[model samples]
Target: MARWQDIEKDAPEFAERVRARFGAGIHKTIATLRKDGSPRISGSELEFEDGEVKFGMMDRSLKLLDVRRDPRIAVHSPSLDPPKEAGEWLGDAKLAGRVVEIPPAPDSPHQDAGHFRIDITEVVLTYVGNPADHLVIESWHEGTGWRRRTRE
Candidate 1:
């Protein structure tokens, strides 16, 4: 897995898109593995701080518990339908990795919170094009770096 700093250094262009898409809204979708190995999706918010991507949930929350038992996670930026004219858009983004629990600090403000740091394994950015053109997909993996793909 790759840390946010490494991603930024190794894939600056992709990291910029990830940051833009993630910061476009306050809410995002986080996917975790349940105890029974089923998929669980929870609404969450991401913070890009200290050169890391972090998030938290209420202590003992189902999502929190899910990550504690199984750290694998997938986070998707808030879905925003592209405008009719596609010159600019709140691009689509996704992050997948294992969650690293952050122990509450001695002076922590939210004692009832469970914090997690994302150790990103993959990042994906999807953007729109003209109606006749294909959607552009840019992806980065832990060690594979960035690649571009397109689909109609």
Candidate 2:
């Protein structure tokens, strides 16, 4: 797994685009594993701080419990319908990782909440190709490094 800074250092432009997409909306989606190993989708918000991806959950929330038991997590950026022109679409960003809890500071506003950071396994950004005639998928993985794929 890699830290957000590692991604940025490796691919500054791609990392910036992903961050911008995630920042485009306030509410993102997070997937956590339930006790039964089923996937649980929940609304979540995250921040890029101190070169790390961090998020919080309400105290004792189901999502929090889920992560505590199983740290694997996936986060999807907020979405908007594609424009009439596919070329105008901003596409989507996603990240999968493991959550590591951090102790809240004594005066932290989230002291009553659960604070955590992600050790990213991968980061993906999909968008329309330059001509907007094909789909472009770019990704970065911890061990494999960066790769790009396009589909007509």
Best by TM-score: 2
Which ranges of candidate 2 are over 4 A from the true structure? Answer: none
Cα-based lDDT at residue 36, candidate 1: 98
Look at candidate 2 and give me any clashing residue pairs.
none
Cα lDDT, all candidates: 0.87, 0.95
Q: Which ranges in model 1 have alpha carbons more than 4 Å from their true place?
A: 130-132
**Model 2 agreement with the true structure over 27-139: per-residue lDDT tens digits:** 99999999999999999999999999999999989999999999999999999889988898989999999999998868888787989999999999999987999999999
Error of 1 at 133 (Å): 0.7
* lDDT (10s digit) by residue, model 1, range 1-104: 78888889988978988898988889999999999999999999989888889988888899988998998999999898777677566579999999898876
